[model samples]
Target: MTAVRVLLADDEHLIRGALAALLALEDDLVVVAEAASGAEALAMARAHRPDVAVLDLQMPGGPDGVKVATSLRDELPSCRTMIVTSHGRPGHLKRALSAGVRGFVPKTVSAQRLAEIIRAVHAGNRYVDPELAADAISAGDSPLTAREAEVLEFAADGAPIAEIAERASLSQGTVRNYLSAAAAKLGAENRHTAVRLARERGWV
Candidate 1:
């Protein structure tokens, strides 16, 4: 059997080393490349063209893992992609799915399970950590669209409406409307309640 060529991308060297050690145990899996940032990950993927690419969601320098996954999905169909992230935000998972990754798993998972997930994805199976899937399902669909959530997240951070509008390139009126709508959807009494609720639900 041909070993699965794997490309691993993460900002943390320890994490990369640990995962590499674990994956190396399986005779059918081989770590072909290692990268410290999303841009480096992409460059390596293009160069090595691994059979599977594992990416970190929030790399410091360059487009995020989801963006890279989208590019790989479009340009390299035979190379499966997975997102391994520390953040368990439901919105993040939803967005990752939209970007066309084959799997999404939290970093808390056992290394053995990660290897299994990679194999599953290589077999053309979709996998999402059960915990994350449950959170996503119970959290329900995102009540706010991306723009609405963006505005509210800014407002929640105490940014003035005008500043929020300017940053989002939206009119003040539109920003206000989005805030009001988000609050109403969250059953929040006001902007503060909306922010707290969104945070608690991992929707932000």
Candidate 2:
């Protein structure tokens, strides 16, 4: 049987090393390359043309993992991709699916399970962590309005209401109104809570 060539990409050194070790144990899997950033991952993928590429959603460089996956899908059609990240945000899942990634695995999942997911994706099957899938479905059910989402995204950075208002090109009163509406829609007690909930639900 032919071995599966794999390229692993993640920002953290320890996590990358541990994942490489875990995947190395798989008799049919070969770690062809490792990347510490999105740019490096893309370069390595292009160079090695691995059977599977494991990417982290958040990484340094202009294009993220989703963008890298999209490129790989277009440029190396035979290479499959799996997104591994600590963030299980619904937006991230949506983006990964849209980018044509074959699998989505949360960082919290066991390394053995991650290897299974990689193999599954390489075999042309789709995989989504059960917990993330549930969160995505729930987020779809309770969608946020476009304006509300914008406000919450700005708020997440600890931006003051006035600053948010100015950046969003709205009056202070308008900003407050948007925040109140978003809070109510999210069943949150305050704007901060609303922002947190929105992010968790992938509204922002």
User: Which pairs of residues have clashing backbones in candidate 2?
Assistant: none
Tell me the lDDT of candidate 2: 0.88
What's the true lDDT of residue 66 in model 1? 90
- Per-residue lDDT tens digits of candidate 2, residues 77-128? 9999989988788878988898899899888988788888888898899999
Query: Which candidate ranks first by lDDT, i.e. highest?
Result: 1
Residue 153 lDDT (model 1): 79
Tens-digit lDDT track of model 1 for 1-204: 899999999999999998999999999999999999888888999999999999998889688889889998888877899999997888778878988898999999998999999999988899999999998888888778887788887887777889989988899999889999999999998888899889777678
Query: Model 1, which residues run further than 4 Å from truth?
Result: 145-147, 169-171, 199-204
What would you estimate as the lDDT of candidate 1? 0.90
- For all the candidates, what are their Cα RMSDs to the real structure? 2.1, 2.3
For all candidates in order, the CA lDDT equals 0.90, 0.88
